[model samples]
Target: MLDNAKYDQINPPSRLLMGPGPINADPRVLRAMASQLVGQYDPAMTGYMNEVMALYRGVFKTENPWTLLVDGTSRAGIEAVLLSVIRPGDKVLVPVFGRFGHLLCEIARRCRAEVHIIEAPWGEVFSPDQIEDAVKRVRPRVLLTVQGDTSTTMLQPLEQLGEICRRYDALFYTDATASLGGNALESDAWGLDAVSAGLQKCLGGPSGSAPVTLSARCEAVIRSRKCVEEGIRTAEHRDGDDEMIYSNYFDLGMIMDYWGPERLNHHTEATSMLFAARECARLLLEEGLDAAIERHKLHGGAMLAGIDAMGLEVFGDRRHRMNNVLGVVIPTGLDGEQVRQMMLNDFAIEIGTSFGPLKGKIWRIGTMGYNARKDCVMQTLSALEGVLNRLGFAGPRGAGLQAAWDHYQREQPS
Candidate 1:
């Protein structure tokens, strides 16, 4: 038996998000999403789509022609790249630093690639020699890794791996979902073959759009596997020479055609997500990518200092931590989840928990996107101080706030 229930108008609590991701989006981005929709192939909509391509190229620091959006979360973009490029039994080498690295390995395996993984401890990242050595040993067709793994709060250095891949004639793909905009990533300059990122992090937008870029080499590999759907095929068009892509929605070649000059229909574009992505990039470019990254740096530094002043140990290698998030080691004799709940229920604040081996061991604090501000950092630190004190975990009462204030003060022009 079914009972009909009436739902009330949408109203949600306002929370200051200080977690690993899904951070508060810029209000400007939300406004852009609210703009009225246009037809999928309407000249105006196509025009907006083209503009989005150009804007994301700037955001990714790449000149690749295949740069475009996947109409889903960050993971969708990653899958689109992997499923399109990886063939059955093709060798792929993955260097796992954290949970997202494991995700890459899992996706590649599902794509039927003969995945080989070399791992570093959770809190650390791999060295180039280590990766190069694995590449030499496996001689894989593709090398997949994550630029930043939010689970471990580690940003893997990618600058040297590209040249190494080139030496072996292997494609290099990195998931940059956790590090773009707020951190340094030069796709063209670093020689990455494919890169994917999401709007929910440093891009200051919601989670629906994933911006991806592919080098000519990577595009060529994906194009080889392209096949037109029977419904959309015309007599003039023949199926691609290679195997048909496994996933209809994730076929990059078809997606490329949709975003390309051909404008072949695939799926109705997620117009609102596109608008949000465009505005996110527009705002970053307007401020200058370097300045936006520096803003993240300033605020992220303050948060770290405040955590230190609170007598909390920061997790992982400080040298390799991402600019927008930090991992604070959970204190002994205190319930980590309880602290998180008190902060949420009392202060209207939200932070994140760890996963896998790190579960209940640390909390991930983020200063990213729209919430990367002095005030946000100060408020978060103050709330955390109060929570810790109430839990009978005493530290210098005002020390965290003072440390953050001191950092901001010193950053002032002398």
Candidate 2:
């Protein structure tokens, strides 16, 4: 029989989120999200919108004026960038190294793009020459890839790809969801034409908002697909003659008008998420973006050291790994799910299982966002040690925590 029970007001368990994403949001970001709402056209609301745009410019390390929030999770930003510029049958080249790369290909195919792909093994990223060779062969209209793929715990080197795309007359884009705030991503300096990221990772915010930036070239292509909604159309409103975007909500051109000086009504913005995104950027900028990235590197390295000392093998190339997350191979004789369940049920901590090809092979642990701290690292490592020991997974007792402390001590102990 179904237990049709009434639940009390929103009580929830407190668990340290040490997984790949959706970690505990920063307290400051939560406070910002709790603020009262205002009308979309309210001066204060519009001012906040403008400030969000400016703040994300710094967060994304770009001077492009199109930097703004997409009022959905990270993939919405990816869709917006892809569907805005990709015409039916337009050639798009995607390099697949992990699950999210497959996501990029899927989104592009839905946009009616003639998608081409180059791939690497799950734990490896494509080299510049490999991508350049594909670009030269495909002569694609756009080249899309992921900056960090949490599924395999690898970060593709993007600094050189941008220049390669330009040299080959192809536009460049990357989904920076797993890496943006915790890793080094130089949007303008790297020649990136489009970059999209979510606030849930190293920004220490919830997962609703996605911030995106576009170079002038990318913006021009989007403007070519511009179509103002009939209800809000003014005499001065002009529609671009190119292909109309399939998605009304994901349309970047109309969204630009919504966020631009025109103050055009597209969709009612998610006010709380806007506040959260703003606060996330404000917090990051206050800490200095470089400093925050270094902090992730610090905690991430400590976690890696602890895992390694416990005799767990990291799943990918160490040189190309993102500083925020890593994949630990499940021990030979233990069920991965049992270990994760014990960590959660007994220790009140949360970590992630891998996806796609890596599914059932590894556990993805993250040191990012508000949870990227020494205490969190030590606690998670220690708890996993306890779980593994009880399950008869062998490694030295107390060694993991000691190794993590030694790493902190050797670097910058505070």
Candidate 3:
């Protein structure tokens, strides 16, 4: 047995997070989390919860009445929806483009659903026809996929897939953790039956809370699995005839009751996380969702121009890439990890590495949420130039920063 050691106060060095996600939380969102807590059922607390639901509907660009927060990270929202709606042996079709698509299949399998998969090469996305062909063959009860898979820096085109799912009578579900807020995702217009996302990305908050919205059809499927708790039962012979949702904690039906007008309790709300999520949506709406997406596009275009000027190859198909992140191919003869280390240790910056196939071959740079700004872009490009030069990876000295500057200048109104 080892003795416990004393630790210092919770101060950590400042970092410019230009990695895949969990970017720096906005100052306003941090302040929101620092506010005092109240009882779970306090009138003010429920009122705040209701306000959050309404705010996320605006963020999601949906009028779905079932929008609410899940008290865990992004995956919690994904699992809650999948588990609540999928009975054992139900079929789920997952199209794999990157790591997160595999994650969806694993989660569905755990729900004891029959998981089917189709794969696209990494650094690319699926065509709606390809997915439609699979749906025609399998006829899955759900067509589940990711909107943006950061592992390959690709955003799947979801617009037409919704119509395909509707034609096949399959529920269209997506985990938008990497694409929401700073990207265009129209829930109702896209015919997305269920949508889930975390505050850690373009919404500009810390991780731990997930915001979700459900179309009316998706809500009905979950409602059919409701099993009220023994203690809270008023006059229940059990509401739904279908098998009860397996996991008590992730039961979306029960979570709905908690967030619904009845004001029932599933568990104590994750109060601080709720505050962070609320402020995240508030900040995005304050800026206007379309405007926020445009901001990401502007900064992302600058970053892309800078990377190209630096003579580095981007990993994915540029036409389908996400606006907030990119995968930069690491040139041969230099260690990618060493370059990342120097950027972190010396310049106080952080970038990410690719996963699976692209691992050790590319550097994933991000400009998302609070860190997506002109200064952050210029500083990161400049510092990267210095790091590459020091590592003996020869490139034009100041071209990257100059390219980024020129791009930004062109975008500014005359």
Candidate 4:
């Protein structure tokens, strides 16, 4: 089974990632990850863990003391929340907007919850009243939604949904993986009970870490089901009536104890990924969250302008598009995958394609995290124009780049 002979040292080709996520991380984050590891119990390591918790509070725009890092990717964070809070037969409502909405439903179903789903067409998001109406009727224990779904390149508006959930006495949770840092997410202000995100997108890091925040209301639900494992239970303990969380690694209660004042042992802690996550939050706070959002908006706007000028049709409702990604409708008579291959082979640039029903019909272009810059937008547009022309889909040579430049010039303050 081994194939060591065929593999070489880790030299990978350089590519400009202009897609949905896993965009190039900030250089400082990588540098931090390279530092040597420390023992899990080491004072310095635990100190960094605490700092990470505090730093992410700012990043998430929350004062919730339960905010902490999950040892896996964004989906891990989602599962952690769902598994800990949702008991068997509990009703959970997920409004399907795109692929990730379906993902939430799937996970909740696996957890043995009674999953109810409402739907909108792929490119559209539900209005606040629509979600509230469902909340009133279904009356789910949790209302699960995604802030941004890369598959559709649409950002669902959450400011109103939170209040709706509170009015109906339901917990509100959102997967902010594609929107956090690059977009506005106010956990406390929005009244969100819990929020989860990944480092691969606007956080400027890879996919190994997930930063999650939980409001006190959500924490109470998780803590109610807390069960100290056999190895960690003391003589004074008694099990609670609530069911134990199904997964050990994703048990947020245990995870919290590890990150909290007790410093209870759970796993050994992913030391390098912890560093990367910490540095991501640090960089974002240093830049300021508002400024980061503005950066994504500006670069993303430039990309839209470039695509528009290229005579390309954009997919989805323009009013609901995410600030970090674009869904460009593949031109008729052009082979979509063929164009993607040329972009990768010749330009060494990576863009994304859609999933589910929209697959093969659109290309997802992202300007996010460290790659959300004037240079990245211009380069991607130029390369894409070249490839399109070469494929016999002819347009003016410099129209794409010119449009992006003009947008930048117009937006620049005097």
Predictions in order: lDDT: 0.93, 0.92, 0.92, 0.92
Clashing pairs in 3: none
lDDT of 3 by residue, 6-96 (tens): 5666898999999999899999999999999999989999999999999999999899999999999999999998998887788899999
Candidate 4's C-alpha runs over 4 A off are 1-5, 226-242
Which regions of candidate 1 fall more than 4 Å away from where they truly are?
Answer: 1-6, 228-242
**Clashing pairs in model 2?**
none
Worst 10 residues of 3 by lDDT: 233-242
Per residue, candidate 1 scores C-alpha lDDT tens digits across 173-251 of: 9999999999999999999999999999999899999999999999888877745575465443444433557688999
Q: What is the lDDT of residue 295 in candidate 1?
A: 96
Q: Hey, what RMSD does candidate 3 come out at?
A: 2.6
Please write out the lDDT profile of model 2 over residues 300-407, one tens digit for every residue: 999999999999999989999999998999988899999899999999999999987789999999999999999999999999999999999889999999999999
Candidate 4 residue-wise lDDT at 293 = 96
Best by lDDT: 1
lDDT score for candidate 4 against the true structure: 0.92
TM-scores for the candidates: 0.96, 0.96, 0.96, 0.96
**lDDT by residue (tens digit), candidate 4, 330-414:** 9999999999999999999999989999999999999999999999999899899999999999777799999999999998755
